[model samples]
Every structure is written in structure tokens, then in C-alpha cells.
Target: MCALRTQFRYLNPYELHKIIINQYVLKQPEDIKLLQRNKSNDRTDYHVLVDHHRFLWEDNEPKTWEEQFAKRYFEKLFKEYCIADLSRYKENKVALRWRIEKEVVSGKGQFICGNKICNESENLRSWEVNFAYHEQGERKNALVKIRLCPSCSKKLNYHHKKREIKRLKKQSKYKKKKSDSKESGSEDETIVCDSSEPESSESRRIEADIPETSNETPWEEHKPEVIKSREEEMEDYLQDLLI
Candidate 1:
């Protein structure tokens, strides 16, 4: 189906924002691989995968019949499932099948939060924020893209934290490698930044020629003059006693 504009014109800005944020689905394993009824879902609430490629973009706007229909379909589900009655949403969608797409980008995109409560701008660093829509009996998976400022992204999307951690670790490791390379290069160049005055080569030679006190024997450290004075005192005292 083609993405459309007419069907979505009736939706106000607030509803559109909510539809954008709350309606899209994060990717799940079952979305790619078929699973048994019990294994199909890790979520207690009904969530589905969204196809990013299906939503066609014209002038950076969702302007196709299929895309618009998907938006409307997801909005309907959002109201009924997430906001309204879950039972009714599930009941209405058992046989209904359709394809819709939400806007998504992997990295380095502007983010405007579709949450009515939070309109946050995010630095696009990784592929963590996702969008999803429900498909009928068949399970499907496609990642919807979103952008939010660091704080809002973390608050709205749990995957944001994981991706952010990875990003930080990668950046730190890169910096460490760069630093190690720089240090090694400096050592190769002998770039020592000693604050003390550097000694002249002649002064260094003199210091090397001088005997190192550290190697001196303990007895050699005693003064010969002191030993001679002690010996003379002892001889004089013995001479006086004999007299």
C-alpha cells in the first residue's frame, strides 16, 4: 500500500506526536524468526515489529497511501491497545492485515520525541531507538527509527542505555589506543618534559667521574683524622699514668 496524507490530515499535532512515539514497535526476535505461541512473545502487552523501508518519504515527510494507512492503523492500535482497551484492540486486529512504515534512521539524525509529554532533541549516535506497527496473524519485524536528546532517549527507550554504553566504551578504547600510540611516539623521540634545569654534557661527565657515595664502604666513610686523634689521646693518657 502507498503512504498517504489525506487520512492523517484529521489528526492534530498532539495525536500525531503520540502516534509517532507510542505506535511504533521496537524489534523483537520473533519478528525475524517464527516462534510457537508460548515462545512468540516476551512482552505482556501486544507489541509488533515495524518495517522501516515500507514507509516512503517525500521531502522528508510521510506522503504515501500505504504509509499513511499504516500510521492510522497503528494509531488505532495505540489508542485501543496502549491507551484504551487491550481486549478490543486484539479482537479487532485478528483478521485485519496491512503494511505501514514509520520514519527511521540508523545514526546521525535529528530526533523530535513523539511523546506529548516530552519533546526532546537527541544526538543520533547509534541504532537504539525503534519504531513498530502491528501486523495481523503473521508476525513481522522492522525497526522504526527515533531521535531524542540523551536524557529523553534514555527515559523513553531502554535500548538507548545499552547502545550508549557501547558507544562510550568504544570511544574510550579508541582514545586509549590513540594515547598509547602518542606516548610510544614521544618515547621514540625522547621528548622528556623535565621541569628541572637540564645539566650540560660537561656537568654530566663530571658527575659520572665523581665517586658515587652510594657505593662507599661503611668503614671508608670514617675520617682518618678522627681515628688518629682518638689514638693519640689514648697514648697520652697511658704515658701520664706511667709517669
Candidate 2:
């Protein structure tokens, strides 16, 4: 009996709900842009539909170029995607976009949560959480999937969402503060430039050429007066009368 690929069968609800539905992460699955230009057909674009696309055709040599390409693709998948850790796939060496790992044993089995801080080994059903982030024109994108226990799944989801919100808030605050400072600086410059009128050299020269007013008292204008004591005056009057 030929044992088929046991990878896809017996998927849990969590496994079924991955964003990219293809068993294999074929490039540009539903790209209408290529279809408009007729650059690609359905089979070529969505290589997952090709039978046993995940299996490397081990003939001595591939019959056609398509079979050869499929063989090469499956080999690459085995070498790169067939790994225990989802975090390493996002690295430059691997660069796997959308893929799933085999499920853990059905019962309560020991597995480590893939959260960075809390990698607590626990007995729970583990599922791979896949997500990606890329800005519009960004060349480098972050493709990530973390195996999570039930508790850590919730915690990590909350953590990622809250962390993103916090980062955006900080960016907003920083931008607003920077803009306000620039506006204030420009306003101050405008006030300074418009407010003060510099005194002209002609005005300064006229003021300097004018004669200054004098504050000193003239010595010729003041008269010296003689002082007489009361006793001396009375004695002098009596002596004049006697004479």
C-alpha cells in the first residue's frame, strides 16, 4: 500500500482557518493582474493544484521541464519548510511565506509555546499562528508564524495588537510634537523679522550732531551775601550811637 502525504488530512478548526488556504505556498495564487496580461495560467501560477506538488519526483531524470521544476520546488520545500521552528522560516536563509507544520499528538502532549518571553513548556494542543507585515513600498517584509499553546496564543495575540497600537501612538505623538516645535520656531522668527524697525544711520547721525543741554550752574550768575550775627549787630548799633 502506497502511503500518501499524511500532511493535509485531519486538520483541526484552527489549522483550517489559516489566511492562505493553499496546502503549498505557491506564488501569486489569485493574481488578476497576471491573468489580464495573460502572463500566467492557473496551473502555472497555482502549482499546488498539480498532483503531489509537495513530493519530489525521484525519477532518474524529469521527463519535461515542468516536472523538473516541480521536482526542484518540492526539494526546496523539504529542505526549507520541513522544519520544527516557524520563526526560522522568516529568516533570510529560509524565507518561507505560508506553510504549516504537522500537528502535535492528539492527547495532552508536552509542547513549548513559541512566545519570545514566555516559552513555557506545557501540555496543550498547539497550532501555528501565521501572519505577515509589509508597508506599501517596503522591500523587506516580516513573515512570521509562531506555534502557540492555548493560553500563550491569547496572550501573544493581545501582546502583538497592543504593541502595534503603542508603536503607532508613539509615532503620532513624536510627529505632532516635532511639527509644533517647528511651527513655534517659525512663528517666533516671523515676529522678530516683522516687529523691530532698525533705526537708520541718518537718524542716528542727526541725534549725534545735536548740541546737548547743560546742567551746570554759572559761577557769575550766583552772588555772595554777607552774614551778620544778632549780638554783633546790636553791639555795633550801640557803639555808633555812643560815637
Highest-TM-score candidate:
1
Q: Supply candidate 2's per-residue lDDT for 9.
A: 55
RMSD of each: 28.8, 30.5
Tens-digit lDDT string for candidate 2 (85-171) = 333432422223322233233111224544433455664333333433332333343323344455654554443331221113355
User: What's the distance in Å from true for residue 22, model 1?
Assistant: 53
lDDT per residue for candidate 1 within 1-243, as digits (tens), equals 235466468789988876655544333434533434566546321232244233222354556655555455444331100101112222332111222123223111334443323444555333232234444444454433333355544444432332432333355788899999998988885566878987799998998899857866789867585445888989999999999
TM-score for predicted model 2 compared with the true structure: 0.19
Q: What is the TM-score of each candidate against the true structure?
A: 0.22, 0.19
Evaluate all candidate structures by whole-model CA lDDT and list the values in order: 0.44, 0.47
What's the alpha carbon RMSD for model 2? Answer: 30.5
lDDT of 1 at 98: 20
Cα error, candidate 2, residue 13 (Å): 55
